[model samples]
Target: MNPLTVLRDSLYFFQRNLSQIVTLCLPLVIVEAILQRIVDDAVGPDASAGFGLIVGLLVYPLYTAALILFLDARSRGESPRNRELLAQAVNLWPRFALLSAISTLLIVLGLSMFFIPGIFLTVVLAFSEYRLVLRGEAPLAAMKSSFNLSRGHFWRIFVCILAVLGPLMLLKEFSYSLFSKDDNTLLSLVLDSANSFLQLFVSVVLFRLFMLISDKSDQ
Candidate 1:
């Protein structure tokens, strides 16, 4: 799997389907951003990190799950109904939420050990959500399968992930620098929406990687 090609194709898909993507996921993204802002205001930064995780677990999975289903439908050349996709995602919410929570906890635990281990864990566990959503595995099983699936493809997956996420992270930092925490709420919402929208491309690239590696492994 060529990471660059995956990156290129993911971006192409993102651009080509920007309208559909936005139509399906943008509300959830904006809602998430708003909820996050509320949490920050309520608890301040010094509050337990778990509060942030809790909020993420509440909002992130809904949109991400929808996007994954949406991407799958598009790849198969089916014109998906946004409402139908959202309904399916809502139905799948509990399991996906569990997967998200597990993934976050593991990443946090790894980070607590050391920064490098956290990155390593992030790379290794990256495919867990795909396994859960795409393959219909239970949450824990999906995580285990992701560990197994990612075993030999660590660098490849890492490269794809970094390629997709690096620029998004940089944009996030730059956006934050442009506005203080107390900056105009509307501007912050717009930037946050943009960042969240672009972050979906990371899932697209990984979906490509998962398909590639899954095919290769099957052979």
Candidate 2:
């Protein structure tokens, strides 16, 4: 549960497997960007926030599940084929999507209550994806397990998530801050796509944390 050790390993694995990570996630990110653009055109400038959120949710689970599986495979010294990994992800999609949608709504609701609650929920339920994808648990069951598993490991998970996502958020803000609202929509999507792709590193970091928690619990 050492945050520094987890961050160090996350960066090490992320750098060492950068190419493979790109191979697993980049195409999906591109497709998500394309779909978002198409939706933007169809819905026009006044689209509801919910519509955009749903659109992102639809594509998000695919790559996320694949990346999680990729990280797990890599941990076991298995070089899984991209197609094979995606096929399994597809099989897991129904549960993953449901879990994601539920998590997103709850987090949004939490955020609405106050920003701190949202961050709290995010840290508390961080392990649901691992439970659902790795253990094949039902979505609700995974959520329950995630909530339970995260207990006593709160600060460690928080730091692991923050170390990766905090900088990512700042980078996106700083990068986009240089641009204007009048900037080309394509430029906006490109910036977002880069940010989305980089966030997959957060998945790798969590996988490391999941491994640490599992090892500790076993001992």
lDDT of 2 by residue, 1-219 (tens): 579988898899999999988988998898898788888789888878787788777888899999999989999999999999999999998889999999999999999996889999999889999999999899999999889889899988998898889999999999889986336877877887898999888888888998889788879
Candidate 1 segments exceeding 4 Å error = none
Q: Runs in model 2 with CA error above 4 Å?
A: none
- The lDDT values for all models are 0.86, 0.88
Q: Which ten residues in a row have the lowest lDDT in candidate 2?
A: 180-189
Question: For candidate 1, lDDT tens digit of each residue in 1-219?
Answer: 778888888888889999988988999999988988888889987899888788888878889999999888888999989999889889889999998888888888888996778889898888888888889999999888898999888998888888768888997898799787476877877888888888888888888888888988999
- Using lDDT as the measure, the top candidate is 2
TM for every model, in the order presented, reads 0.95, 0.95
